[model samples]
Target: MPVYLDHNATAPVRPEAVRAMTDALNHVGNASSVHRFGRDARRRVEDARETVAALIGVQPGDLVFTSGGTEANNTALRGHGRTRTLVSAGEHEAVLQARPDAETVPLRSDGTVDLDALDVALAADDRPALVSVMLANNETGAINPVQQVVEIARRHGARVHCDAVQAPGKIAVDARALGVDLITVSSHKLGGPQGAGALAVLDGQSVAPLLAGGGQERKQRAGTENVPAIAGFGAAAEAALADLVRMTECAAWRDRLEAEARALCPRLQVHGAGAARLPNTSCLGLPGVRAETQVMALDLAGVAVSSGSACSSGKVHASHVLRAMGVSEDDADSAVRVSLGWTSTADDIDVFLDAWGKLVRRHGLAADAA
Candidate 1:
């Protein structure tokens, strides 16, 4: 069996989530109707919305359900129509894809946004500014200090938006606690079905609507509700919260994998080891071994992993995250990410470590003999 270690890309849907989604699929009614069936459907949708909101410690009315994280991010960044956007250098492509007219905030060597630098940028003339920093990095699992960043932005009179997609289920994310104007989360990253996500906005924070249609999501996201996916998302949030205790075990597995990789190849370096990180993620670099080559080798050995974020084009690229962290281009190109989740087991870790050892021996000897 292949040992799967790519939770940062997307997690497997949990059984409870699947069941909730299946049940919701059988019910029929538009969420925006006054009839009995419509009211029932609308009730289910709102109930799910409330559950999702509770998981993140926000009022149910504050959550705006969207297609997924990409849409949520777009709505958060573009909707405000701020003239300047101070986006972190290590942000996910969804935020990085903002218009060139927006300004880029270079990250510190540790992959965290430099708030002092951001303040300097925002203090010029006091125009409307938007600052977006991710709550966690997808590749390195480096957790950003969003609350601190929010404080800095707020002091400079700038609106703050956070992409908390990778932070959910691994770290605590209370929108009320973080005090950001907007936060984005994806259902798929937290063991829920894809095509379901939410953007939590504080009571007074308003953004331009991304979609305009029959009033749904309170005229915020105008479209027919994705009832099944929303139900699954709510169920998954409940299930993930129930398994918080399992995170410690997953961290042990990640540590063992890193130790074994270094034992096999002493030159291996784990990214973000000096900073706080999500316990389930590790990005490692092995000198002279290209990430794509190791990824294919691991696949052949029945141990699956990835160089970085699994791309829509199915091609491996050099990691932008590592580059922002000051890793040399060669080392960044050779990095691979291994992440764990609720379903990960010790046996899976054993399989991956054994496969990695075999590949290192085979390749290391071949290069030596030549």
Candidate 2:
């Protein structure tokens, strides 16, 4: 079996999610219709919305179910009546793509946004600015100081939008306590089926519709709801919350992988090691090797990993996150991300270590000869 170490890209769908989706698939109705079947579908959609809200500590009324994180991000950035936008330098493409006129916030050395610099950006006289930053980075797994950023944004009368797509099931994402105006999450990131996601706008705040149709999502997002996918997302959230024990248990395996990687290559640099990170993630840079080369080598050796953001996969560009962190072009080009999840086992980590050791040894020998 191919040892899947790329959980940051996407996780395998959980069995419970599959079962829930299968059950919901048997039913059919447009949630907007007034018929009994439509009412039932609407009930299911609301229930799923509540479950998603509970997962992130937000009121059900505040959640707006969308196609996925991309749409949610677009809605959050474009809607909500915010005039100006302030985006973090290390945010995912979803956030960047939605920001038509945004000033990029500077980043720290650990792949996190520079809070002071962000404060300066917000200090601009642009009233009612929207600040878009990721709760956890999709590439480096770097957790941003979102609460602090929000506090600063609030000082400047700015609204905050956090892309929590990579945070669900990996970290505690309390939308209320985090004090953000808007937050986006994707179902697939938490082991649910794709085409299901939500954007929670804080109480008393509202965004205009991204799509226009029969009013769904309380008219915040208008389209035919995908009840089956919503059911799967709800089940996945339930399963993931229940599996917190397993998620915590995977930390040791991740640490083992990092240890083995360090032992194999003494010069290996681990990003975000200075700050707290998700237990499942490790972003390491090995000098004298290109990230794509290493990724391809590992794939050939039956181990999967990523060079940078999965959204930018197959592209030959250096990581924007790394550059934002002030990482040199060469170092950024050589960095690879190895993330673990519920499906990862200790044996899988050991096998990965063994493969990495062989590859490192071969590369070291080649360097010596050169």
Candidate 3:
């Protein structure tokens, strides 16, 4: 059996979610209709909304379901009508490309956003501004200090938006505690179906709809609700909440993987090692081997991994996240991300280590010893 270690890209669907989706798929109704069938479908959607909302500590009424994380991010970043936007250099392309004109806040060497730079940038302009920062980075798994970011943005009257898609199942994500005005989350990241996601608006923050249509999602988002996917999302949220302890336990395996890899190649670079990171993620770099080469080798060895975010149409390029943290171009090109999840086991780590050890012995040691 192949060992899957790329949970940060997407996790295998949980049994609970599959059951819920299957049940909902058998139903036939439009949630917008007034008939009994419609009411039942609406109930499922609302129940999902409540569950998803609880996962992030937001009001059930505060969420507007979208197609997925990318749409949720675009809605939050673009719907606010802010003339000026500031996003961390390490953000996903959804946020970066949402407003190509947005100013970039540099990151510290540890891969967390630089709060000082954010403060200075927010103070630079008097125009209405939106500050977009992620709770946990997808590639390096570095957890940003979002509470401090909110405190800084509030001083300049800038609304804070957090792309929290990577944080729910792996870490505690409380939008209220973080004090972000808007937050984005995805279903597949938490073992749900991929087509569902949510944008939570907090403290009476109003966001204009990206899609204009009938009175759905309280007119915040317009379209017929995707009932089966929403049901699966809710079921997945509940299951993920219950599995938090197991997720945290994966940290030991992740640490061992990094430690063992370092033993094989002392020059190995673990990006974001100096910062608070998600428990299951390790961005490892073998200086002499290119990332694509490592990924391909590991795939052939029956251990799956990724060079970086899977968003980029199956291409392996130098990680922009590493580059933002001031990693050298050569090192950036050599890095691959290994993320664990609830389905991961100790044997998975062992298989990865075995494959990685051979890879280092074959391709890395000679270059390092030179």
Native-to-model Cα distance after best TM-score fit, residue 165 in candidate 3, in Å: 0.3
Tell me the lDDT of candidate 1: 0.85
Residue 213's lDDT within candidate 1 is 68
Worst 10 residues of 3 by lDDT: 361-370
Worst 10 residues of 1 by lDDT: 361-370
Task: Tell me the tens digit of each residue's lDDT in model 3 across 34-64.
Answer: 9999999999999999999999999998999
Which residue pairs collide in model 2, if any? none
Off by over 4 Å in 1: 365-370
Cα misplacement distance, residue 100 of candidate 3 (Å): 0.2
- TM-score of every prediction relative to native: 0.96, 0.96, 0.98
Report the lDDT tens digits of candidate 2 across residue range 1-370: 8999988888899999999888888887878889999898888888788788888989988998988999999998888687788899888888887875788998888878899998887786667788898999887788888999889988888889999999889877798899998999999988999888999989778888889976677888877889999989988987877777776778787787888788777788898777667878988888878898889889999999988888764774578888888889998998999988878898889888887877777788222334
Per-residue lDDT for 170 in model 3?
A: 96
Ranking by TM-score: 3, 1, 2
Residue 43 miss distance in model 3 (angstroms) = 0.7
Per-residue alpha-carbon lDDT of model 1 for 142-253, expressed as tens digits? 8888889888888878888989998878877798899888889889998999999999988767788899966788788999999889989999998887787788888888
Candidate 2 structure, TM-score to reference: 0.96
- Per-structure clash totals for the candidates: 0, 0, 0
